[model samples]
Target chain A: MLAFLLDPAALSGPADGASDMHPTRQRLISVATRLFQQRGYHAIGLAEILALSETPKGSLYHHFPGGKPELAEACVTRIAESSLAAIDRLSGSGLDMIGFLRRLAEVTAAWLQRTDWLDGSLLAVIGQEQGGVNGPLSEAVRIAYQRIEMRLARWLMAEGVAVARARDMAATIIAAQEGALVLARSRHDAAPVTLVTDMLCTMVDRG
Target chain B: MLAFLLDPAALSGPADGASDMHPTRQRLISVATRLFQQRGYHAIGLAEILALSETPKGSLYHHFPGGKPELAEACVTRIAESSLAAIDRLSGSGLDMIGFLRRLAEVTAAWLQRTDWLDGSLLAVIGQEQGGVNGPLSEAVRIAYQRIEMRLARWLMAEGVAVARARDMAATIIAAQEGALVLARSRHDAAPVTLVTDMLCTMVDRG
Candidate 1:
C-alpha cells in the first residue's frame, strides 16, 4: 500500500525528526486501513495488522497512542479526505456534472473489481461490525458520512440548485451510492454500482 | 426473541411432519435471529444459539440440516416475510395511501426504537455479513434484498402508480431506508430513521 498521510513529514525529510515519515507509521496505516475496510474494524486485531504491515509491535504505539480506536479514526479521516479529493479531481476535469458522476462510478467499479469485489469503506464496515452501539467508532462513521454528503451538497450548489433541495438530494445520492455499494459487495458484482449511477444521472436529468 | 417464523413446520409439513410449529424449532429461530441481529452471523455460534434458546444440540440439526447457513437463511426469510406482512396489514387498513406509508414508517420506527436504537433489519445485517466472494450467504442476501424490492414495488404499483416508476421509487426508498438504518445504528439514535422516513413520505406525496 502507498504511504497515505495527512502531512509530508510522514513522507521523507531530514533536519527535524518530526519531518521524517516513519516507515512503521506508513505500514501500520496501510495495513490497518485495508483489513478494516475488508473484514470490518471489530473483526480485525492489532496482531494481524502488525503481521500484514510487517511492522514490529513495539513501534505500533509510537504512531497510534489510542490503539485500534485511534487507528480507526485516522483511517476514517484519511478515507474521507481522499474521497473528497477524488470528487474534486473528477469535477475538475471539466466533464458535465452528470457525466462526472458516471465516471466516478466507473472508477469506483474498477477499484472494487480490483479488490475482488470487496467493500472498501472502513467506516461503513465498522459501523455494521460494531452495530453503532460503540461511541468513538460510531462518531467516526457519522462524521465521515456527513463529510461526503457535505461535499456532494457543495457540488450541487455549485450547479445553481436550491440549497435545501441540493442538500437533501445530495444526501439521497450518497445514500443510494452507499446502498448500491452494499448491494455490490453482497452480490460480488459491480453491475449494481454502475446501474445506480445511471439511475441517479437519469434522475438528475429529469430534474 | 419472539418466534421469528410464523410457521416453521411448513418446511417439513410439505413432507411428513406435524401441521403445527415445533417448540424447539420456533425457539431456535427466535434466538438465532436475535443473536444474528445483535451480534454478527459468523460471530455467533450454534452453541450460543442452543444455550440461549435452551434447545438441545440434537434439535439444531433436526431443524437446520445445512447448519448455520441454513439457520441464517431461515431467519432472513422469516424476517422478510414478517416485514412484508406487517406492511400489507398497514396498507390494507383502508387508510389513505400517504397515510398508509406514514403508518408503515411509524411502525418501522417503533420497532427500531424498541430494539434499543439498533438497525433491526435482519436482511440488511445478513447482507453485510455475507458480503463475501461467491458464498451461499451472499446469494441468500441477494435474494432477500430482491424480495424486499419486489414487495415494495408491488405495493407502490397497487396504489395506482406507474409500474416502471413505482419500481424505481421502490428501489430508491428501500435503499434510503436501509441506508438510514446504518446511520441510526451507528449513532444509536432514532432521529436518522425518522428523518429518512419523513423524506420518503414527502417524496411519495409529491409523486
Candidate 2:
C-alpha cells in the first residue's frame, strides 16, 4: 500500500547541494511536504524523509532543530504561503468573482489529478489530522487558516462586496472548498470541487 | 502531548459484560470512534484502544479479527449512521431550511464544545487523513459521504428545491460544514462553522 512512495523522479534531484531555489534545506521541505501530504504526520518517519530528500540526519537536524514537528511546521508554513500566492494570482487575474471561483476550482482539480490525487493543501490535511490532538501544531494550523480567510475576505471587499458579507463569503468559500476537496479525494474524483464552485458562484451572484 | 487521551468519562462503562446497549463490542466501538476522531487512524494504536476501553485482546480479536482497519471501518459506519439519523431528525423537525441549518450548526457547535472541540466526525478526520493513502478506508469514506449527500438532497427536494439544485445545495452544505469543522478545531472555536452556516442559509434561501 505504501507503493505510492516509489516515485521515479524522487531521487532525480541534485546531490543535496545544487538546488538554486533553496539548496538542501529546500529539498528536504519539498519532499517532506509531499510525503506528509501523501501519508500523514504519524505514518511518516524522519528517516523516510531523509532518504527521500537524499539528505543526511546531521543536515536534517541542522536545518530543522525540533526534528519532525519542526519540519512539519515549516511544511505547513510553506503550504500556507504558496496557497495565498495562488489565491492572489487568481483574485487579480481580471476574472469576476464567479470566474475567479471557477478558475480556482479548476486549478485545485488539476492539482489533485497531478499529484496522483493525494490532496490539494497540506495545511488542510495536517489541520484535520492534528487539530485538537496536537496543540502546538494546531496553533500554527489555525494561524495559517486565519491568514487565508483574511486575504479572501479582503479580496471580496475589493470586489465591492460589503465588509461583513465579504467576511462571511470568505469563510463560506474556504469551508466549502476544503470540505469538497475531502469528498473529492475519497472517491479519487474532482467533480465535487467543481460542483461546489458552481454552487458558490450562484451564491456570489445572489450576493 | 498525548494527555488528551485521559478522558474522565472514558472508563465509566459497566466493566466488560454489563453494557445493555451492545455489551463489550459496543463499548469498544464507542471508545475507538472517539480515539480515531481525535487522532487519525495511523496515529492511534490498538493497544491504546484496548487499554482505554478495558477490553482484553481475545475479546477484541473475537469481534474485530481483521484488527485496526476493521475496527476503524466500524467506527466510520457508526458515525455515518448517527449523522444521518441527526439529519433525518432535523429534516423532520418543523423548522424551515434556514432554521434547520441554524439548528444543525448550533448542534455541531455544541458538540465541538462538549468534546473540548476535538472534532465532530471520525469519517471526515479519517477521510482527510487516509484518502489517498489507504484505498479501502477511502472507499468507505466515499460511500458514507454519498449516503449523506443523497439523504440531504432528498430532504431539500421535499422542501421545494428543484432536483438538480437540491443536489448541488446538498453537496455545498456538506463541503462547507466539514471544512468549517476543520477550521473550528484548529482554534478550539466554533465560529467558523456558524459563520459558514449563515452564509449557507443565505444560499439556501436564494435557492
User: Judged by DockQ, which candidate is best?
Assistant: 2
**Interface DockQ of candidate 2:** 0.59
Q: Tens digit of lDDT per residue, candidate 1, span B1-207?
A: 011112333223332222366767767876787777765676577889989988888889988888888888877766665656655665677776568656655655666666665444566666665556466766766776677667777878888878987766666666656665666566565555555556666667766
Q: Is the docking of candidate 1 incorrect, acceptable, medium or high quality?
A: acceptable
Model 1 quality (TM-score): 0.75
Write out the backbone clash pairs for model 1: A10-A21
Model 1 per-residue lDDT tens digits across residues A50-75: 88888877788878888888888877
lDDT of 2 at B113: 87
DockQ of candidate 1 compared with the true complex: 0.34
- Interface RMSD, Å, model 1: 3.0
Clashes of 2: 0
* lDDT of each residue in B83-155, candidate 2, tens digit only: 5666676677778899988877877787778878775456677886775776677777878888888888999
Total clashing pairs for each candidate: 1, 0
List the lowest-lDDT window of 10 residues for candidate 1 chain B.
Answer: B1-10
